[model samples]
Target: MNSEQLIKSLLKQEEGDQLEFKLVVQKDSIGKIICAFLNHEGGQVLIGVSDDKKIVGISDAEKWEKELTDYLNSAIIPEAPVMVSLEQVGNKQVILVKVWAGSKQPYIFDGNIYFRRRQSTVKATSQEISNLIHNRQKNEFHWERQPALGVELEDLDLQEIQKTVDRSINESKLDENNRNPIDFLTHFGLFQNGHFTNAAVVLFAKNPALFIPQARVRVAFLEKGKTAGEFVDDKLLDGNLFKNILSAQDFFEKHLHTTRKFSEKEWERQDDYVVPMSALREGVMNALVHRDYSLPSASMSVIIYSDKIEVFNSGKSPLKAAELKKSHLSLPVNPDIAHMAFLRGYIEKIGRGTIKIMDACKTAGLKPPKWTTTETSVKLSFPLNIKLGGATDGGLVGAGDDNINIRIDGAIDGAIDGATTRTIRQLTILLAAIIKDEGKRIPDYKNITDLGSVRTLERYIEQLKDIGFIEFKGSAAQTGGYFITDKLKKIIK
Candidate 1:
């Protein structure tokens, strides 16, 4: 609507949530009114209109606008933008002061908090002020600040702390002064009064789940849907939050379907998830940072089915589905944990998780994840992009793994990103061993790869399977061994 039309429409209405009227521009009083509007739904304070709806226009519209804008900038803490325009109504000029509801909130004007209540602008009560402070401190207070019982400084991993410090320093998220583990922890408030807070333990503890066992993640691969399915793989991931994130990624990678992006040259090929890795990573990180840790009986879980993959976490998100789907507000259940995670780079930015996930899915040419929530739990379902053997509506195609078609074009490429010298060596050895001695146990593969750690061997196997280079023969009831897939051979030639 035009300025005059808008003014006329607002004139006929009573002042309420988004409407306010003022006779003259009182700098201090107007600032408080603006603060109230910002704290609530955005509204306009119409100058030249009185409290009783009298249309006594301001003599100099420009003068009132300049004065109010100056006062707002100088008097408001965390200066917020305001719009002031002179509009003509009949023969007189009216000043329209527009304020937007702030996302970076708890706005203060002239040392006082103000809020609007149904046409009335008033000073914020003590309780209201407290609530605002608490909300802002979501990451400042909570489990992250509380000391973990029976946990000591030595129990934490100094290497992880050092890595976090180095990266955070390079990113300028943290200063270079605190380079040591203890100093870094102290500076970030991870160490409170000579005690390690629960956040410190969760981030750096050798075994974080020792204190909070339910903090671990459980991942499963199922042949059917949510209700019932033949379990292909089920494992509990335990360790620090960082470890759990890595383990969860490994678990998902092994189960999620991938499609081949064949290159013009036979050897030049790329493999990727149809749903995108970014979306899955975001979902897992959300489950870790925002899950309710108070419920000891509940644990975070990821379940894969033929049609979709569901990531479940204990406790319902305080944020409504509408809020997540719209505003992208950052209201973390464990703010302290989130704060550390942010500095450590577990999360890219605050309040952008769901939006990132949606965008990632869209970019990958897939539908966005389906969100489901209960009072006790929250679940995110990402539908598998590929229709497994022409199965569309969550129904299985047939017996045997061949029913699910994984179109792999070539053998595993050791030259792919993140392939170090040792990794390449391991891969070359494993591939040769699998080709030379088919259907051998992991011990035999380990001997050929010369990778002593079982965990490391398992990780490489998972990566190989994820890229469609190899498959395990035999079942849970019988001995199984890794073997190169036929698809890999088809492209290798």
Candidate 2:
């Protein structure tokens, strides 16, 4: 809908959590409302509207829009994402200020955090502010922020901490003035309230495995069709997160096959590993940075198979399996750890690690990486140049296993070979949505597939039903929806 129609529709509604009406543009009141909206789910502020749902418009909306935009940019901490526009109602103009939920929370206005309480904007309480801070850190009760019991300055490796500070300064990620280990720890929120946090221990502890056993990584090399326990060689890497990362790289270099070939065209020799080291390094860093440290009994693992390698960690990604293939938000399970990893030049803050892994594999003429997540763990698999059912002539293998490839190939050839590319893409999207959740109704599929008409979506759905990929269950009046059939589930498995 256009802005005029949307404003007219909102005019009939009362003030609520996401809707606020003001007769004038007061910087103080408007700032509070904007801050509250950012702290909560996003909202819209309609200036020149009264409390009783009157549409008495403003005199000059252009001036108000620019002024309010400037005020919010300077007043709100961290510079909230807000849009100010002038919209014409029936006979007058109104200033519409739209705010989205801030990824970085606890938006402060005039030194106080504001939150929306139903239809009112008020200053946040101490407990509410604490919750916002924790939520901004991406965990309700962040394990990394907790005090490390029995850990002191003596327990941490002072030299390693100093080296990190130096490296960060050289990388222009930190100010050179704060060169002390204590200062570095305090600057990164690793030291708080006169006590060292668990993050500090994980990053600088002399023997982190002694205190946090799960901080270690287990690397193993298994033959074809072998279990994890029966490994040809394995090692339990210890020390800090950075140390373990480097040690894992060393293990990969020693075990993974490498080839050196002379290129006459270039007058030089080229060397490469079976899989790109960049992809493996990224996978390992992701496993460490995103691991669930609260699960003290669980540890990360790097398992090498004859045809693939798997990096497994005890934490579920906030993103869905299909979402990883596209652009998505970066919702790190451990924000503190992720931030430190970024500063050290080990990872990026944006959610591009998976994309980088896939791109690197594709550039190397290998199959794209796959991400699989369970209720409590996430595993990333990288394929190698080994044929499963055919002769191995040093060629990249296909994406999935033999059974899945056969089933999917047969289904596609029999059902969708004659369909248009757009229809096939829509079918893939529909199947992904249903696999993610079977209770999705027709409307949900339409929204996901971006189909403007239900009739068009039903045609695609009918095709799937005819192919035995999905089946309808229950009645339309009751809890009825399209669900994946056993044939599709077997192929997925």
Candidate 3:
């Protein structure tokens, strides 16, 4: 807003979190107010404005502005960058000093650390001070170790604990001792004095999203980058970390393509993912276990684009991407969560997740995953091998050991009367794509179609197969695939 509009807006509002009115620049107290604003969400101090929201102009704003700048340079511990400008309010001149929210927390003035709470500048409590220090130094931050309020032992999923124990025992990492869930939690330090830590809440809570609103993984299948465009499959994966991980994996598996090749000796079909599932899982688990939960507004996310998938978590890595690409130490943001994930066989070699993902991508003959970061978030993007209408030696189907070309035929017109010719053509194109490769199940077909229910699509497939236009393959128990018949090819011709 312009100076006049800004003044009018500021005058209309009361002095609160983002704004404070001062009649004059009090040299001693002004620094404290600025420090408080810097420590909290940065705010504006309007000089020449009265307590009652009157626009009483300052006599010498230029003089006071000079003094404020000089004081700021010399008074604060770390210099706070601010914008100080004199704006004309009617006949009066009001100085607007705007201080932005600083990345450096606990900005100190003189000997005290100040914080802005509502309209007052208060000294930070010991715990608040500790939190500030921890926020600045990520390695020292233990947000997961902090107790999750309103959480109880019963809130945890007993099945999760059992699964962890079972995995540990099978791996011989733990003895098959029948320790109770509570005792096991205590042993891992997730159960503190009469309370569950945030780590415990994340790993085992029936719905951790209830305790931590931003704990869930947000997955979006976007047509365009970042925007939810045509063909979007946006969903928030909630519940405990394990459940979210599984849900995210399911989402990826549905959207991603697979390459199929037959083994000569065994006559067995081997399916290779466009992006390695292991690498994707590692990325997801790492995001879940190491995200900065202290950032109450931020949540982890898996965004899938047509050509790529991005997995993001709040909080930048302590180690740089280049450093991680080489040998580097792992400094997990949530150590307690990471520890539990490690024990559960979710994460391996604490610091090797990045290297492994890169190696996996290379092994699959795909481009290396791109790692990018901002001050508040880390993102890993894995590019997809196939684009729209892009064809490889085999398409998105893995049936038995043969490649087949099946032409769309009018022979199914009398047999299947429900669907339109356009719909049938679309279905034919989809099945033909599969036939070019091996074969695909209903889920893969649903992904290709991306518009109908599984049961509905299954009926159509059955009708086509029954009419002798398509043939079925693979085990009946499994979601087997369909191939166009040679007899139908003659009818179309």
Off by over 4 Å in 1: 1-141, 224-229, 262-269, 387-493
Candidate 1 lDDT over residue span 5-121, tens digit each: 657867888888777788887877788888987776667788899777877899878777667656675576644445566878888888877755653357898788898889898
Worst 10 residues of 1 by lDDT: 401-410
- What tens digits encode model 2's per-residue C-alpha lDDT throughout 324-372? 7653344567766776676576764245577678777875556788999
Query: How far in Å is the alpha carbon of 213 misplaced in model 3?
Result: 0.7
Taken over the whole model, the C-alpha lDDT of each candidate is 0.69, 0.73, 0.69
Candidate 2: where are CA atoms >4 Å away? 1-140, 227-229, 261-267, 387-493
- Poorest stretch of ten by lDDT in candidate 2: 388-397
lDDT of 1: 0.69
Task: List pairs with backbone clashes in candidate 2.
Answer: none
- TM-scores of all candidate predictions against the true structure: 0.55, 0.55, 0.52
